[model samples]
Target: MNNQTISAQLLSPFNMGDLPLKNRVVVAPVTRSTVGEKRLRFMAKYYAQRASAGLIITEAAVISHQAIGWLNSPGIYTEEQAEDWKQVVNAVHSHKTPIFLQLWHCGRASHSSFQQNGQLPVAPSAIKVNGDYIHTPLGKQAYETPKALETEEIAAIVQDFSQAAQLAKIAGFDGVEIHGANGYLIDEFLQSKTNHRTDKYGGSIENRYRFLGEIITAMTKVLSPNRIGVRLSPNGSYNDMGSSDFRETFLYVAQQLNQYGLAYLHVMDGLAFSFHELGNPITLAEFRQVFTGPIMGNCGYTQETAEAAIEKGDADLISFGRLFISNPDLVERFANGWPLNPLVDRKLWYRLGEEGYIDFPAYASSS
Candidate 1:
């Protein structure tokens, strides 16, 4: 494929609903594990550095104290936290780049150490994550069996997502993406392996989807459906996710979400993150068939692969996580064929410092 042709496809301008993008490339949300009072300033710089991307999804911000698990990660539950994030939004908007806040709830992925008053983490079921360890504020600790949320308690958590969406708007975010992927709180409710409840929120696929469905309904009350997005990781094994009915579950999810007319459906279709290997992985084409809205494909997409996905009509936008981290000027590199910086070491990915976070120079500076 011609480099210029490749550039035109991936780095080209596109419209996701009413939102116009400068390019089709997206800065996927990444957990830096480096947020604190002092780190908020760094967070602003970190996101502002890559404002050239078509859209930027800020790292998953915990929706409530019950939603926190990652150490030092930002939270949007309080007015003060939302005010802090407003600065980051201003920094990105300074470049005329549209950014979205990803509302997250860690669910059973968290430990009591991260919870208030040392209460057990909550989930749809009482099962514990199969993972060996979770990084808590105390230290690296074993995964704890979570408290199963009662049917009566589900409404409050759903309202938390709604309140978080409203807070995101107040923070001046152009939009909000619900973090429903990668074995997090929402994902735990979606997958059968994790959700073992017999209430209205569990049992069959429709019942299982009720938790996320209610979240969307609640969020739409504060934010327009067009200003919202949802992420799904049907093929991932992260946090011990993936079920026997994975294909049926996600396709049904897409079909239902289609009725909502969301801004986009972000699907992690690439196997770069280990796949569950239960059966054949679900593809973007599968989602495209059901979801009528714009589709964003993520996970391990190179310029060539991203270009192909868009050119083939499989994805309207392609998000880059590691690439965006290393090459802040990823769109320019694809447009001009500049050499990309080497991938940073995994250990340094979540470290709290400027060494490997925002120190990488763009091609203009490097050359």
Candidate 2:
């Protein structure tokens, strides 16, 4: 295609409800274990560096202390935590970038050491994932069977999500994304293999989707329905999760979410770039038909692949994860067709320092 044709086809703005994204590039939610005060300066610097993207989704911020099952993951339940995140939000906003906080709950993926009073992790079913280990202050330990959440407890958890969304807004996030993906609590209820409950939250596809629907409804009241989004991994088998009726589960969830008139649906295409057994092998285009709203495609996407996805109407937006980890100015590089800086250290991916976090050189400096 000619330059004009290519530019016309590849570069276009997307309207995510009331929010107008300058382009289709989004910085997907990524977790770095900077919690409380430590995360304030670090996360602010990190996001401000990548401010060129149309939108940035902050790492999954735990909804409550009970919901936090990982070491150093940030929480949104307290006033102090919200205050700390306000600085990060302000930093990104100063660069004129819109950011959304990804609200999360680990469910059975958490260990007792991470829980208060050494309480058991909660889930729809009291099952322990088979092959995963969790790091504790004491040391690494095998996953433990979680306590099945009682029906009453489920209501409380939903409220926690609602409260967190409110807190996120207070923290000055442009919006909030409910993390219903990656085998977390919401995903646990959505997947049959992980949820054996016969209550209102499990069994039939509709019942299994109850938790997600409730969460969306609750969050919508706190934030406008047009400002809310959800991230899902339909075929994701992460954390020992599966569904005999994957199509039914995801399709129903999408249809239900569509009724809310939410801003967008972020779908992680698990089978795009690899031969992995973890996520279902669904294409981003397939999910497009199921979800009529704006869709953000993620997972193993390159600049060319992302551009193609936008050109073909497979996705209205593209989210970059690890690539953004090393190259904060990823959108500018892509716009100028510049070479990417190599990921120098994978060890620093989850490390709690500014070495790899803030020290990556921009294209101009590297050249």
Candidate 3:
């Protein structure tokens, strides 16, 4: 496709702080089982195929032994794991793609088997969000009522995140994105419904946001604030999450994050799965009003819709999830106005091997 056929907004060069890109399209993180060395090899190939992205955010990797919940997700806490990740960085960098490792902790969304010595999952409170199930080695199990982290223990978790950020740097990531969304550890603290702590960590909005702010501060010691970005889902029900005062809480959080001069704010809303039904619904535009840095709008954005959102000034960039999974050449397809491949095999998302993982054909082969 010629440059004339591509939409100007998407193909136009853009700058997101230290990240200069050929376009504003990003490949959002997607979970793949990290069971062994072979998987990391697969992961390297998985990311390299989509290196055309302006920025690639890797799947959420657990920060520490205490932070695991996803049964098969990858990690970066150990020296060996970091060494393995170096291969991934080399693969993506070969194509000159800028990538970020997303540091995460599952919090209460975990079962005993995933934790060391069968220890209970940890969170801000002993509350359990029912209806959500976690996959364990034994099999899928219901969510556990997590052990409440003592004030001292809370600090340890922060340090774990700090350590992980440094490890990510050592692994050769361009930067890191804190996974502060999707009802995980950081999100558990931010939401009033989940955080019942009476101490400084949980009463009001500021208290709830304290945990997230401290994490950002810690990461900045090793990486530039301009190179750091955060993902938040103020209106998501993915992990059975919600609060009575989501608007006030999230707006306060957004306003505060602006002070750090972050690279971008990636938000997920307006999709059937990410509904904000319980509270006053907030949009990306409202966040734009509060945060000066760029905002990336996620959750099922088509090429036409993404371009329109950018033109309307609602978002500086648009991230693709499922589309990127099935179309390795998603940007090229969109740029050339080629029809998207609607054949997504969801059944193989968690299955082992490369059939549905790295086997998706590029545009040339598919056409």
Candidate 4:
């Protein structure tokens, strides 16, 4: 089999709504603690380095002060942050690359030390995530019980997302991808195990989906339906999350999202020992059955696997995480069938400064 032929197939142009990708290869969102004033400067160089990708999805960015629970993660709620992002958007666009910001909220995954005035973490329930540690100014410690959000508070959260979407547009982002996956606040509401309430926000599947549906509706008011996207993890067990009926929950969400005519649906197929272990695994062909829009599939994908997914019509595009981290010219590597560089030290992933964040040499530099 000619690897070049396979590589060409993977690098072919694809469409998501009105946006045409240069190739099917996408750089997935990966948080690396590169934010604040320094983050703006670093991202300009960082994204500019990987401009070869067909599309670039930035790391999850908090939308509100209350929504923030992680250290050093960027936010779009403030004027300064929005202005900082403007530079990032300008840099990526200068290279003619379309970029999307992943809007996020940490929910119960946050530590009090990271909260305002050291307030408790918030979630759908007051439950504490089992066997998880959070970083504090002092050091890493076990997660604590989170404060349950009231029905009224939920409405406020929706408004925060809407405001954030507007800010993203102001920042010159091509689009906004709602971070509803990976056991975050939105995922907390989706999982029955995490959300145990008798109010309108909990219980039935429709009620559980109400939070996400409202957020999407609110965001669409600010961003066009075609310019908006959503990310989900149907069978993700992260943050001690699960449901009695995972497939039914995700199917309902997918079918409903299809009605909105969104740009794409990005799905994370939980961390599995093998690809076979990925549950609620919505293949590109399977997802097309429910959602008429484009689909981006992620998790444990190799170059060959991603190409096969696109060829088999399992996905319109493939999202690369660690591969993009090590290979700034991943699209070029895929196009030419060049061997990829191995990932550097994991300890440096969140470490401040440019040691691992911006110091990775590109293929040109290596040559």
**In model 4, what are the clashing residue pairs, if there are any?**
284-314
The candidate 1 region of ten consecutive residues with least summed lDDT is 33-42
Q: Please, what are the lDDT tens digits per residue for candidate 3 over residues 133-164? A: 77887887888788999998888888888889
1-367 in candidate 2: lDDT tens per residue? 4333433433567778888778778999988776544434478888999888889999998898788776677788888889999988999999887899999999998888878899999999998887658876567899999999999889899999999999999999989999998889999999888889988898888999999999988888899988888998876666666666776778778878888888789988744423325344667777787888988888888877777888898988889888999998887677776779886465677767687788887897788
Candidate 4 per-residue lDDT over residues 1-367, each given as its tens digit = 6668787667888777788888888888988876654335477788878888989999989988777766678888877788989888888888888999999998998888877788988998898888658776558889999999988889889998999999999999999999988789999998787889789989999999999999999988898899998998775777677676777787788889988999899987635412223354545466667877788988878888888887888688888888888789988877766778887667767866677777777776687
lDDT computed for candidate 3: 0.85
Top candidate when judged by TM-score against the true structure: 1
CA lDDT scores, all candidates in order? 0.91, 0.83, 0.85, 0.82
Taking all chains together, each candidate's TM-score versus the true structure is 0.98, 0.94, 0.96, 0.95
Worst 10 residues of 3 by lDDT: 32-41
> lDDT by residue for model 1 over 227-340, one digit each (tens)?
999999999999989899999999999999988889999999999987999999999998989999999999999999998999899999999999988898888888888889
The CA-based lDDT of model 4 is what? 0.82
Greater lDDT among 1 and 3 belongs to 1
In model 3, how large is the Cα lDDT of residue 107? 94
